[model samples]
Target chain A: MPKLFRKVREIRNFLRSFRCSNDNSNSIGFVPTMGYLHKGHRELIRRSKLQNDLTVVSIYVNPLQFGPGEDYETYPRDLERDLTVCEEEGVDVVFAPTDDEMYPEKPTIKIEIPGLTDVLEGAYRPGHFSGVATVVLKLFNIIQPDRAYFGEKDFQQLKVVQRLVKDLSIPIEIVPVPTVREEDGLAASSRNTYLKEEERQAATVIYRSLLLAQKLFSSGTRNAKDIKEAVLRALLSEKLVSKVDYVEIVDEEFRIRDDQVMEGDRLLVALRVGKVRLIDNWRFGDEAV
Target chain B: MPKLFRKVREIRNFLRSFRCSNDNSNSIGFVPTMGYLHKGHRELIRRSKLQNDLTVVSIYVNPLQFGPGEDYETYPRDLERDLTVCEEEGVDVVFAPTDDEMYPEKPTIKIEIPGLTDVLEGAYRPGHFSGVATVVLKLFNIIQPDRAYFGEKDFQQLKVVQRLVKDLSIPIEIVPVPTVREEDGLAASSRNTYLKEEERQAATVIYRSLLLAQKLFSSGTRNAKDIKEAVLRALLSEKLVSKVDYVEIVDEEFRIRDDQVMEGDRLLVALRVGKVRLIDNWRFGDEAV
Candidate 1:
């Protein structure tokens, strides 16, 4: 493991120097996160190590993405613990930039997906994807990674980032890793730590609902409305799941589905367990559904 | 003049190639334009050539920016004429890409500046700047120019592009050139050709209002509202000026101004002459206003 300093200017200068270095055979892969490293992040770093000569991991809890009432300040953060995990995972560089370093000046530009953003998380929290798209694009430019990894737990965010890269013709290739789940099938997230013991137990219904829907889809239940209804019923059964934001069966491009589970289509579900919102999705292939 | 043939596999391929080439030198200056080259474009090319080692001019009339009822099909296009002018200007590369070439896949990504966009041209035609930002960002990546030039003729657009570059940290310097105008003070544009002889003569009010605002600001007119009112009155006087879209004195960042002209403040004016819309602006400085 190569230990790199943790400063934005230093990291940028280092990248510039590396570009001019004599070593022309090394390729760098980057995985950007918002600290509180988990198994999902470790998996991303592990894949980066396996594929590249160097791996860079960035941890920034971007304030721009959080709404007025959202958890910007209260969001989980632990640099020391994150660094240890990164070291264990063989990360070559850990770029943890300060807020000022990331945004020297106020950002006036915004990236927005109109119709797509007006639904799901975007509907719940307006301007969320715009913030995600802006920050992710900024990171991609600064890192100039040959490849970057994003977990599919934030399926909508992953889709938005993919669209941004495709639309803007960003040079970096985005590799979306599968959503890492707990043993109980709940999608692993940094926010999952916010759940109380009983709330944590009740959070299982989110995954349970998704699993039930998946099972239904596989067992000759192809109607999207029925699956959505079943998932809603399962989530409502859990007292801790205060709100069912949306349970959608969408096509690969995130377009809402009708009656059938076409091969390669995805079923995405989002639910608010206490104060924490968790999202997960599973793709249906011909063999499975 | 170095003419290079670009066989772009994708926009990313183009960006990567440019990045590798740019790292070895100061890189080229870029001027992106919709085809239908006129003397105004030549002026931009001249400025680009003077400022950088190489000049790259892109001729792409992005379809995304055009509204449904807007003159997308009837929009002026003359690639052969544009090529002749570019060749005469000693442009290093002329990136005349097909719509298919520019958007290989359907574009799902959109970039928008809300408050700023909700007014001005964005107010007139919904989602215009989103399309402009998306295409401009795509071109910025494809060309990877050290400095990109945008005419102040479209003041709102210039501000939006500047914001995009700054907000995204897109490793390119944005250089806003002065609006090139005809002898009658009409701002030159590719769309200028759409005007009939009478309408063309009447189009002078677009710049006339801007000039009036500049004159007032220079003559110790410190109040923004007063200057705006003066410009609006001047534009409204012209019978051929069908609609006065907006006339405002704003700060450099496009924020609405109240009182006193800051040294680096800007005065923007926009109006419709017959069916064509035109915009212009002037910076408040010793030599400018």
Candidate 2:
């Protein structure tokens, strides 16, 4: 690993300097995170290393993307531990910029996806994906990565990023990796650490609901409304799963499907376990019986 | 000009084909425009040719950026004349792609700017800048120009593009060339052709109001409200100027300014000269004065 000690200005300066440098073979892969390193993040970075010549990981908990009363401050962060993980993962550079550094002045401009952001997670978290799109785009530019990796745990987010890249013509490839899960099939997430002992056990309902939908789909249940009801019932039965935000069965492009799920459709589910929201998804035809 | 005849498969295919061609010395400067070519567009291409080793001009009337009942269909187009202009301007490539070629599938994603876009033209034509930002970004990615030229006639749009490049970290340099105007102080625009002979004369008020603000500012008038009122009165007095949309003095960054005028601030004004809407602006302490 090539260690680079940098502040915000230093990172930007380094990027400018590298643009003119004759190191053409140096391919940089980037993984941007909101601090609080988790196993899911590690998998993203690990995959990045295997593909690129150098890897850069950015940890920034962006405030713009957070709506009023959302967890902007108490979102959980540990830079010291995160640095340790990046070092172990063979990360060439670790960018941990301050809020002021990331946003030198008030952001007068923002990027938004219209219809896509109005559904699924977007509906629940209003300007959430817009915030995500803005920060991720900023990181993409600052890091200037050849390839960026995103996990499918945030399926809607992956879709938003895909649209952003396509619409903006951003010159980077977005690689969507499989969602990492815990032993009981609960999707691994940084927020998962927020769950209490009992809440942790209840969090498994998210995956359980997805599994229920998958089983039904395999058993010739093609009606989206019926499958959605079955999944909702499974989540409603869990004691610790306080609220179900949404249970959607949509096509690959995230459009709501009613009757039949074609070959590449996905069944996505999001539920709240003790105030912590967890999301998980699985493709219809790809799951084993 | 090495003209190659092949329809592009996708944005990626176009970029790959351009990159594979072994011509490293030539730097490409791009000027993107709607189909109807005018003297203003020709000027942009001329400047592009002088500044870059190769010039590329793309004629795409992007529909995603136009709102319903906003003259998207009635927008003027003359491909043969546009080609003649390109050939005259020494343009190395002319990317005249069909709508289906550009958007093989419907775009699920869009680009939008918040507070900045919510006011002025954005208020009048909702989702206008979002459409502009989306299409401009796409063009930027497809062309991959070293420098992109935009006229200052669309002052808000120039600001939005600057913000997009800054926020997104796009590598291309955004160069804002001066607005091209006619002999009668009317800013040159393709839409000018839509105006009747009398409406064309009345359109001069758009620039006249901007000039009035400049005169007031230069004659030791420091109050923003007084300057705006003068400009508004000037536009309302014109028989052909149907409606005065807005007349305000803002700081360089498009922020509303109420106090004494700074040296580098701008006075942006817009109005409807008959059925055609026109906008113009002047910067304090600039050579255009």
Candidate 3:
């Protein structure tokens, strides 16, 4: 069974004690998540376990990442179930800190990644990426893991982390895991539980639009405008998806790829299914030009 | 003699190899500076040598911290002299990377500490503190020193770093060494080299103003306005001094202390003598409030 830590102070001390122990060869893998564990989270933990001698998972629904009128208060969290899943998955440690513990003082330092952060979700929710970057940095400092795992479901976030680590010269490997999806093609999210019966089924449109864009790109449509238009059309076709937040076809770096869809370009879609917002993305094109 | 490493990759590897050595109890103390070593910098190195098993110093004039018209190009640098000083001080390693080594990619992330950073030097030079914070954090990550030394001569910078380490939970102790001054009370600074003979002699007014403020507060005067007015009079009395940039009384944290003078509150003064700018500060009142 994995040991659970509630306080940042305790967990930090525990990690430090282990670090100071003569075992210099031990490699720690970290998986940061907001609770309500599902099959997707399990895959991340399983990957961490396979790659490192010790695996640490942090489950804290960070309040800083949510803007005003966002679903921060309504975010799902179940510690008991999360602990059970961690134990069953053979996780080494689970560091879950309270909001007060995580943020003892209002963090004055705002980590703003200008061009990369200000698009897509950043446009829809201002100051969101900064919050994510700040908290993730704080967590990274505390854990000091050998290799940290982040799922590409949050494609923009993964890219931001990659840029931050490289730009700052942080000596840790950032391992990107492919997005984990449900059998129905809907990207598994804690918010997916927020959907009502009919809304749950309609949420698949978010994934469908991304897949459709990828299919278009695979079928020899190089223009980003056409791919994005096709994605918007498919998403809006679902009546239960009340709104299309964004349908962007950008290169790996999140810059707008309007001229042509080259290799490793991404097709991203975000939509509102009833009251719940869903997001999904897929990479298109080959490695070569 | 301390070994000199000019590449980020080589220095990081050297540090990591030392970190993994069987002597797990060894503590590293770091003092980061932009070259052109002086008495103030030597004091920081001396303190680091006394405290840790190994002491590392980084000498790189960060371009990111300088404004458009600022003196980045004219910044004094004598690596041979700097190496001699490091050897005299018994330094362990010197990490001196070029501009390209420090900033390979244009950093998109701006680490801005809003309320704390927007005043003082920040007001005079926009984006200066953000650049300082960013580079300092990068150096701290690269060194991973157990304790870091910072001189209180750059008082605002010391406070910002303290906040960054605390807020980010960086597990390194920040030791603030008292400001080293010349026999004439002029604060030791690299910019001091910019002053002509007459300007150098006249620049004592900056230090004099701070002393006068301390005298008034020490003599039982409590009004901030009175303290500031007296400081301004003293600074302007020197004919060679060109302009008074700022003469203000602030608390330890750099916030305006408008009311009664209290213990540990700082009186800060900045002025231009010929083409060179000088700054100095004096703490008023006893340690106890």
On lDDT, the candidate that comes out on top is 3
Task: Please give, for residues B156-260, the per-residue lDDT of candidate 2 as tens digits.
Answer: 888888888877666678888888889888878888899999898788877777777777778899888888888889889999888877877778867888888
Task: Spell out the clash pairs found in candidate 1.
Answer: none
For lDDT, candidate 1 versus 3, the one ahead is 3
lDDT of 3 at B199: 86
Residue ranges of candidate 2 with Cα displaced over 4 Å:
A2-28, A223-226, A258-264, A286-289, B1-28, B42-54, B196-202, B222-226, B236-238, B256-265, B272-274, B284-289
List the DockQ of the predictions in order: 0.58, 0.46, 0.70
As a whole number from 0 to 100, the lDDT of residue B128 in candidate 1 is 88
lDDT of 3 at B210: 79
List the candidates ranked by lDDT, beginning with the highest. Answer: 3, 1, 2
The lDDT of each candidate is 0.79, 0.79, 0.86
Which pairs clash (backbone N, Cα, C closer than 3 Å) in model 3? Answer: none
Best by TM-score: 3
Instruction: Point out the higher-scoring one by DockQ: 1 or 3.
Output: 3
Instruction: Single out the weakest 10-residue window by summed lDDT for candidate 2 chain B.
Output: B2-11
* Tens-digit lDDT string for candidate 3 (A248-288): 87876778888989879888777899988888888885221
In terms of lDDT, the poorest run of 10 residues in model 1 chain A is A17-26
